[model samples]
Target: MLALAALPLGVRVTVLEPDEHAPARLCARHLHAPYTDPAALNELAACDAVTLEFENVPVEALAALQDRVPVRPGGALLARSKHRAHEKRALQGAGATTAPFEAIEADTDLPGALARVGGRGILKTSELGYDGKGQARVNSDAELRAAWENLGRVPCVLEGLVSFEREVSLAVARTPAGQVAFGPLVENVHRDGILRSSVFPAQVPDGTEARARELARAVADAWALEGLITLEFFQLPGGDLIVNEVAPRVHNSGHLTQDGGGVSQFEAQVRAVLNLPLSDWRPLHPTAMVNVVGVDGPDGSPLTPDWAAIDALDGTRVHLYHKAHRHGRKVGHVNLVAPDPGTLRARLASLEPLIP
Candidate 1:
């Protein structure tokens, strides 16, 4: 998507992806090899400026390229983001509040750690966990131990659950020159631990928006953020925000901005990385987005989308990822815009059937 957005600017892209079938291949030069492959890293170093669009890229590989070209939101931030414990520290250091958590370094630490988090918490691997994987919700000490054992006894963080009324996300893009443009507080919905939908103009209590804005700016300043950072939060009943997780890249929650009649996150990222001017972050209309989760058929092909039903709908735009489908994978998303929130909700509710 970044490549797609960059095309109009006459910017050439070179993608470093291990997957031969990576979607970016269609739009950019595809270097197909392991991320740690020294040869691939060397080739990537020749680009004018590099930006990481995903987490889990080895920070060492990025560090190697820093001497040759600019790496926005570079190695230090990636190192902090790759581990959950370090991520929480980064959040707190940026003066943002996060959920209570205890680090689990050994089996003996489980009982004490669980008790510290109010005797019940979600145990997540310190590294490489997403979409409900590498984490378990445990209600007992034995369950906590079992969960840790199930994760291969790796270093983990047990975070106590909070009683929050809603989940919201804030995304900000910053340039190396220090200009910042913030996407609005996006109201998000998740089911089975995956993002389902996002709505703009998050209806929060008065003053919540200002605090979220402050946190986004502080984190960007603290990290010396060069591209984009998305901060997902748990919005409490009274509108206080608690950090749920942070992603130092374009995120699922911000997909709605593509059709928001304003500067899309993808384009903002391109402009930020290239040191181009950024527009203000306000949109012209109410917008919403829904993810198209893949549900494969008997022979392992994705279930065909209901085009007839989709065509029957109006005022919605569909974007497909064009990757091989696997059960529970995100294959595409649909966006809808309306003059008001109520109309957008009704139109989005009608899209649910077409996805399944």
Candidate 2:
């Protein structure tokens, strides 16, 4: 919602978030904030079009809106994206490399299914999981059983963990005219499996960026996706790329696009949904982003950020999601730009200690 509000030109943007007062369906375990409430459904339903910020939205709700508005990346992508096992299967079927995985229903052949994907693995709920939640690492049946217990013993899929050199992602958008453009590969740094920062101009081999973009386009076309799609991959120790996950909406990794791309992710999605020409996804700066999670002050109140220092950095842009401050919640982000790597690193280092 914040990103869409930053479009470079005047464009109408309407976001349909689940009602804050709705039954609180345990949609994704984490959502920073919503742009509106349920009463606005009529208003949203009357909009020219709609785009999703994440993939966990209920298909039923989207279907309800379909008769009244154009929903980009409609039901097909949503159905495939909601299930982990199905998403990986789609990637492999599309001739994209992916980690080995198995699907398991809480009531069916649980033991044998777990055995199929042998050794230490990551277990994720088939539905309603994101940002390190609804997932657990299992090294044995005990761990698997415990994960089931922790995850409320829901239907889930288990995937063998990829021992990769690093993680990188490509963001691509397809226009109504079938034109496609890709942003450069983003080098991601994860803290305990949750994304902590993203660096543009991924420090990889000469051909890596090209290959990543090609693969991302392939995956998007495979799903017949028509809007923004984010494909995350792991560079294996042998220099091979394996698809780790696919997000059918705007992504955290694309945040740098705001200050460093010809078209920001938000505007690109808008264009794709509106069937406008896709812009070049080239880098506009050597930039990096750090998530501003809610931190407690010494007195136990929500820490009041020094927005002055954050906005003062050269080529820096900050976004603060209007969410109630809570521990570990992603309340906002800080982006910094520099002429070279040295300045970028120094800027990040300078902001790290002060964030908390």
Best by lDDT: 1
lDDT of 1 by residue, 1-356 (tens): 99998999999898889888999999899999988888988888888889988898888788888778888778888889889999999889999999889999886787678778887799999998887788999998889989999999999999998999899998888988899988878899987888989988787898888889899999999889988888999999998999888898888888888887888888888888888998656457898888888887888777877867876787788899988888888888988788898888888889877776
lDDT of each: 0.87, 0.75
Tens-digit lDDT track of model 2 for 1-356: 43343344456554454455321123221222343334455566776666777687777767666668777787778878888888888898888998788786765545755667767788889999877888999888778878878888788888887788889988888875688888768889887556888888677767887788778888878877788888899987656799998888878988887777466776777778778877767567788888887778788888866788877767778877667777767888887777887778788787666566
lDDT of 1: 0.87
Candidate 2 deviant stretches above 4 angstroms: 1-8, 19-45, 112-115, 297-300, 303-312
Query: Which 10 residues in a row give candidate 1 its minimum summed lDDT?
Result: 278-287
RMSD of each: 1.5, 4.6
Question: Using alpha carbons, what is the TM-score of model 2?
Answer: 0.88
Score residue 204 of candidate 1 by CA lDDT.
Answer: 84
Clashing pairs in model 2? 260-284
Candidate 2 lDDT (Cα, whole model)?
0.75
